[model samples]
Target: MTRTLSRAACIGGGVIGGGWIARFLLDGTDVAVHDPHPDARRIIGEVLDNARRARARLISAPPVPEGRLSFHDDIAGAVEGAEYIQESVPERLDLKHEVFAAIEAAAAPGALIGSSTSGFKPSELREGATHPERIFVAHPFNPVYLVPLVELVGSGPQDEAILDRAADILARTGMHPLKIRREIDAHIADRLLEAVWRESLWLVKDDIATTQEIDDAIRFGFGLRWAQMGLFETYRIAGGEAGMKHFIDQFGPALKWPWTKLMDVPEMTEELSAKIAAQSDAQSGQHTIRELERIRDDNLIGILHALRANGWGAGETLRAMEERAFAQAHARAAHAAPDPAAPLELHRAKVGGDWLDYNGHMTEFRYLQVFGDATDAFLGHIGMDADYRAQGLSVYTVETHIRHLAETGAGANLTVRTTLLGFDAKRIRLHHEMVDGAGTVQATAEHMLMHVDTQAGRACPMGAPLTERLAALAPGQSALPAPDHAGRPIRDIGWPLGEPA
Candidate 1:
C-alpha cells in the first residue's frame, strides 16, 4: 500500500511556496512553512485568502476540513517529521542546493522531496543531495491552488515508485501531474510559455505593440479556445473536418516565414525595462493587486464553470473531483446515521457572488437549486446512489413548491435539513428547509419525486432494501405535526377579500 501524505513542509514561503501551502492545506494536509524573509507570513496569508475565496467559488460541494498551518523560522524545524517536503526557494542553483540539503537532513528518511524550480533540471537540483533519488521537480503554474497542472520530473537513476507516490499525492490534491520522460532545462509547459514570452518582449522592445494589446490579442481570440482545447485541437477544428494532418499540410510552409522572433533575444536595457513597466502600469495600474486577483479569479470561475458544463479540458477535471467529494460526503453521512428528532442535515453551502440577483440577495431559482441538492443527498442516503441509478432505476423530481420566507445575501452560509413527509411504493414526498447560520428559515421547498425505471421510462417501485429503510424513517416523521405552509395555492393574497368585480 502507498503511504498517504497527511503533513507537508514548504521550504520557501514566496509566491510559488505560498501557493503550494494553500493547495496542500485546502486538500486537508497540515503544512509547516519556513522562510527567513520578514514579510513571508503576510505574503503567504494574502495568497491563502485569495485561494480560499477562489475555492469557495469553484467547488459547489462541501469541502474537506481545512488542515492546520504553522510557520517555522528554520528549514530544519519546518521539515521535522514531515512526510513530504517542497522547496520553492529563489530560482538559483546554489540556493536550491543549500535548501535541499537542509530539507534532506530534517525530513523523514523516506520522505519525498519536490522542488518548485521552473527552469532547473532535477539533476542540477539534486547535485549535492544525499538522497538524490528522493528529489524530483514538481513545477506548478502560478496560482498553484487553482491551476491543476504540475510537471513531475525525476533525476539520474530515478525511483519510479517515488515518482508514482508524488504523482498520487498531487492527483489527490486536485492536480494533474504530467510525468516528464527525460530531464530538461525548462519542463514542457514553461518552455512553450518562454517562447511566447520571448516573442512578446521583442514586440514590446521594438515598439510594435503595448503589453495590453498583446494580452488582448490572446484573451479575445485563441486564449478562450485554448482554455478548453489545446493548440493542435483548435487548429484541427480549423481544418474543417479534414483533421490535424490537413491543418499541418495547409499551414506547414508558414512555419518557415519570419513571423516570430524565436531565436533572437531582446536586450533588456534600463530604457526598455522602464518603457515596458510604464506601459504595463498604464494598462492596469488602477486596481490594487488584491483587486486584480479577485477579477482574475472571477473570470477563471466563469470559464471553469462553462467548461464543467461541457465536460471538457479543465472542466472535466473539476467535474470528476466534485463527484468524488460528494461520494465521500455521502459515505461519511451513512456511517454517522441521522438523528430522528431533527431533519437530516446533509448539505451545506455558502451563497456564491454569482448566485446573487440584482437586488443583492440569493435569486429565487437558487432556492430550488439548493433544495434539489439536498434532495439528492436524501436519495443517496436511502440507497439511490450512483451505482443504484446505474441499474436503470432512480428517483426523479415530478413537482416542486418553494416558499421564500426571508432574503439572504451573498457569502451567507446556509444549511439544508431534509425531512421525509411521506412515501408510497412509487412516490416519495420530501420537505427541505434552508436556514442561515443562526437557524433562521431562509426558504422552504416541498418536492414530490417518482421512482422510475429509466430504461422503461415509467414509474416503478423502489427495491425492497430501500423501501425497508424508508419505512423505518416514515414512522418517526409521521408523529410530527404538518408544516404550516405545506400546501398553498399560487394566487393573489387577498383573492377572497377582493372577490370578482
Candidate 2:
C-alpha cells in the first residue's frame, strides 16, 4: 500500500529471510531471492502460505495486490537491480563478508543493504564492505512478518540518514522500526532476552523449575503485560500513586540481591542440552513445527487485533499500516470511479478461506461484510475520508435489503456495482450488485444511508462539498433507468395456501 521498493532482494531463504520476503511481497514489492539450500523453495513457500493466512485475518483494510516472486541460484542474479537487499545467511562473519562482497558487486548503486544479524554490531557487519554506509543491522524477532519489531542499528553519524530511510521503508510495510542510537553487540531487545534466557537456564540446572514451568511463569505472567506495555511502563503502573522513581526505589535493591545468575556462563554440557531438549519435546511434541507456527500466528493476530482496537503499543503501527492500506486502495480505485451515467465499480474482494461456513460455502455474515465494504467504497468515491469524519459528519446506513442469489465459495473473486437510486437533502437510497468472476450475480443489497452529525447524534442537512457533488451527479443518475427491485419490500406468502385455512 505504501510506496515500497521497486524490487527487493533477499540473500537467504531460511526462516528470517523468508519472513522478509513475505512482508515485502505482500506489501506489493517484487521480490528476488537467493538461497542455496536443497529445499529452499519448499521452505519459503510454506512460510508464504502462513503469511497469507495471517494477512487475511489481521488486515482489515483493503488488500494490496500480491507482487511477483522469483528465485535465483546466485547472489549476483538476485541482487541485480534491487533497490533494497537483505542479507540473512549464517551468522558466521566470514560467510557474511563473502555475501556482502557479492551483493556489493551486483546490487544497484543506491541500494540499502541490511543484515539480519542478532549479535553482530553494524560495524562488525560492515568491516570489509565496499559501500560501508549502505550496510547496517536490521535485527528482527522470530516470525518476522507477524511480530513487526525491527531493530535498525546504524554504525556511525553518516548512517543516521540511511537508517532513517530504512526505518521509513520498513514502517510502510507494517513494521515498527526501532532505530538504535549507536552500534552495540546483540542490539537492544536481544540483550534483555539474553539475561532472562541465562537466568532460566540456571533455574533449570538447579532443578528449581522444569522447562514448562519456567515458560508458564513468563507466558502466564509478565509475558502478557510485556506484549502491550513492556517492562518500564508496567513497572510505572505498579508504582501506583507514585511514579517510576518510586518503582525504582522499591526494586533497585533487588538488582544486587543475587536473585539472578545473568552474569554466570552456564556450561552447555551434552547432558544439559539433552535435559532441556527432552523437557521441551515433552511440553510441545504433540504438534509439528509448522502446526506450532500457525498456532502462534493465530494467537498473535488476535492480540494484534485487540491492540489495534485500543490503539496502543505495536497496535499503533498496525493502525498506521491500515490507514496507508485504505489510502492505497483509494488511489487504485481512483481510475475506476465511473461517470455518474454508468454504475460505479469501486469495490472488489476475493473471499478468503476463513470466509467459508461449515456448508463449504461463504458464510452468511461475510456476505454482509462484502456489501458493507462496497457501501463504504461508494461513500469514499464522493469525498468522505478521515478528515471529513473528523468534522463529526458521516453517512450511516439506516436500512438494508439483501437477496442471496447463488452459493459462494472460498477464493471466489467478487466485484460490486453500485447505483444511486435517489437522494434527498439528508439521505440516500443506493443499490449494490455483487457478482462473481464469471459475471453471475451472487447477491444484491439495497441500503438507505443518512448523513448525520455524530456529536449531535441526529440527522442533518447536507453541506457544500457533499451537496454540490450529489447535485452534480443527480441528473445523470436520476435520469437513468432504476433497478426493478428498487424500493421493493419483502413479499408475504400465505401459509401453504389452504393449509392454514
Cα lDDT listed for each candidate: 0.86, 0.88
lDDT by residue (tens digit), candidate 1, 48-122? 999998998888766767889999988999999898888899988988888888888788897889989899998
Taking all chains together, the TM-score of candidate 1 against the true structure is 0.92
Q: Clash number for every model?
A: 0, 0
- State the local distance difference test value for candidate 2: 0.88
Question: For candidate 1, what is the lDDT?
Answer: 0.86
The segments of candidate 1 whose C-alpha lies over 4 angstroms from its true place after superposition are 1-4, 156-158, 383-393, 453-459, 464-468, 489-501
Candidate 2 — which residues are off by over 4 angstroms? 1-3, 337-345, 353-365, 380-398, 403-413, 424-427, 435-442, 451-485, 489-501
Best by lDDT: 2
